[model samples]
Target chain A: MTRALYQFLLWLHPPFFRQRFGEEMLWIYDESAATHGVLALFTDGLASLARQWVMRAGTWKLAVAGAGGLLEILMAGFFVMGPAPTAHVAATQSIEDPAQFSGTWKGSLRSRPIELVLAKEGTVWRGEIHFQSPDGALRSAPLEDIRVAGDSVHLRVQVDDSDMTFSGKLVPGTLGSRLVGALQATADASDDLISYSTLQAFHA
Target chain B: MREDLSPLVPLSPAILHILTALAGEERHGYGIMQEVARQSEGQYKLGPGTLYDNLQKLLEHAVVEECSRRSAADNPRRSAGDDPRRRYYRLTAFGRRVLLAEVARLEGVVRHARLRLQTNNPRRAS
Candidate 1:
């Protein structure tokens, strides 16, 4: 089952890591697998494997005992196993309930283009906001203190030491088809919450 | 001596979050992940690999250190309910200084950028 595959992934990690965090990783899998979804869990496992290998790059520890035999068996196993099961609960669930805020909302704040990506996991809502600089590069930040009331939404993004709070509401029809509001940054409190609308065209 | 943190200024976001989380209190791997997510209001998430590898480097650099149960016992705030088997880490004094320096450096950059912005667009001045 998924448990065996996860265990196999864990086994591929360097021994030093397996010795340190093997049980804790398994414990987390047991506790949050249902919440984080199967796909995210496997992705996390793969990330851990890559990290351990990369960090041990220069050490003699790279020559792990039994790794040669293990790799041969794994390649054979990969040929035998079919496509991996995927649970996209994070994507699908974000469309339901509280995650109605989920999507890519693109617009301009004070004439600067910004993009916000929102998703919900378990009860926690997490996402990032990317602001395109004048040079065409983008500097992004994570959204914080997300509060929703009726159709109104409020979120904050920290830019260095300053905080910009976006106070807006979803244009009603169904879900967050459109969002209109003003983003007032704390750095310029004297400024108004200049009117604007951000289209959620990136994600349906 | 300037105690040059120029070499460490502009830390990667991952390292910054990890250091900030440990600054609040010592924590295990899961605790650190949860703390970063909670601190940033669920916006920033650290995967197991990202957490440990950066943590390993921080440990190697001595900015972060493993805090065994006996070491954690000295910390009055550590809860009794914490699992004894889980390893905990905390930011060292040097790490705190580095974080503060980074913050200060960022503030200066923001300030300088703001001044330039106002100078470029006189009407936007506030």
Candidate 2:
């Protein structure tokens, strides 16, 4: 039964994945089938289907295909809606070079802590933060949307359902300093805030 | 509630590999292939078809996430001058937690096997 189900998934995959990976994948399927038998074929098929669903769920079509049609439809709905904003931000901004952002910057938000680390890759930055409220509750979020422009650095921090964009000027001296300009949330208003004393670069 | 049991349990090795690749960072299809190869030290080579198929299953499980659209420039395997958009992937916290659990489960099997082997061959244990 598992083998049959595997075969069925394989049959469902080519049309779905070929649209993105081009014709090369079809040849791969043929080659894998020649060597690894039905198991390899099924593995290949399942992998392709997994890739499509992850990368191209936005393009999925829900037309009934067979006994699995209902499953497909249900999966489509889950794919479209699962992974709320937090998941989206993490997945989208997972690539950050910690060297570039390895500095301490101060901002003024009473609720959130602001610390950025720039790593060796030279292009990406990861911001680590801590949030503390008056009631003494603590929370933390990783800031992935970091952009460096000339002497200015921009950091986007997502807290819960809202995204806050912070623009700061890099102060030049023996050490790098950042002065916060304005902090605004992208969507939905929340009382959670961030504040800094003096932004300082820290060696990671 | 019992019927609510997972429809798909005991995910395939390919699916596990795909999930493990995304656990640290987001990767595109080829990126995933490369990472999986690296992780297994080339023991597991996933062709494009197989890579994408496993990706779909992980996506269905919400264990893998699509990070973004990639241009040719984003593809490390592409020539430096060639630019095309390629999607990136990352493991959700849920995905990471689940993968860790799966790893523990697999480790349990290995531990049991080792115990059996040791019992069967006392010299091997030494």
Candidate 3:
């Protein structure tokens, strides 16, 4: 919910401003959102929205000849109106069998053990993730944006300020099965994907 | 080119702290936040709004520039603490000049303040 509002404010910025620093701002927000208070986080985003519109060009580097105005309008439209740019894997990927991922599995991520749980609820997939934090404490987060495409699987869980996304394929080995993919924590579901590759496959 | 950074001199507390944080190496927003607190020993705390507000201005004035994420996290200081790998910002050449100018300007101010206070002290004046 707070993230939804943060994105909404991000959407409110001028097209040019959004084009340059949308993901950057969101990245920073996610980094601190876990440790900082909500008031501090939202206040910064709200003020930036107002400032970006008023300041015009905080980091404007127009490399093109006359495409500035045109690019601004197009980007603005894309952000405000969906449909045209909704071909992302999260939306385009189809689930052949959601039941395949309907069990708890464990794997090593970032050299730390991670556990993920997925359950289908009336055609909808829902689950949570668990991992050991830096302080040697266990932390868990609910799963969101569960996308499955044939053997490809993608799951995102909101951990503190950032979204931890897992993308791997289900591999059938002689010894049971494993979800072999990389788990990455990103600033947003879309925008920029910061790939901290963890190739440890989880076995049920 | 020796640009006149005097107009931008006497940087605001927030901007100065931010530039100082970026002075050593490129950093993400969270890195900057942590650096500011560490440098100031928690005397000065800059929320995200103020940091970016000033950062936007710094970028506008060409005092700062963005760089790739990989280049930032590969620094020697990565082991010093935990700074998440996010979009990174570095002080541009022009930005370094502005920061040095501000620092020099602050140095003079501190010197003058110390001398003035010392002279006003009865024991020191004697």
lDDT tens readout by residue for model 2, A1-204: 644565456556544344334433444444345544657656656765765554443223222223244554566677876633222333333232323345655442422344454432445565666546446676677767777654456777777776776654433335543343344456544433322112233332
lDDT digits (tens) for residues A24-130 of candidate 3 = 67777777787777777787777776676544432222223124545555676878765333223333233235467778888755445778888888868888888
lDDT per residue, candidate 1, A59-172, as tens digits? 222333234445655666688675433334322322224455777877654346778888777777788988865467788889998876555577887766656777665544
Q: Tell how far residue B117 is off in model 1, in angstroms.
A: 2.3
Score candidate 2 by lDDT.
0.54
Better of 1 and 2 by TM-score: 1
* Model 2 ranges with Cα > 4 A deviation: A1-15, A20-204, B1-9, B69-82, B122-126
Q: Output the better candidate (2/3) by lDDT.
A: 3
Q: Which DockQ value does candidate 1 get? A: 0.09
- Candidate 1: where are CA atoms >4 Å away? A59-204, B74-81, B122-126
Which of the two, 1 or 3, has more lDDT? 3
**Each model's fraction of native contacts:** 0.24, 0.29, 0.35
What DockQ results do all the predictions give, each relative to the true complex?
A: 0.09, 0.14, 0.15
TM-score of each: 0.50, 0.38, 0.49
Which run of 10 residues does model 2 chain B get worst, by summed lDDT?
B1-10
Q: Which candidate is the best by DockQ?
A: 3
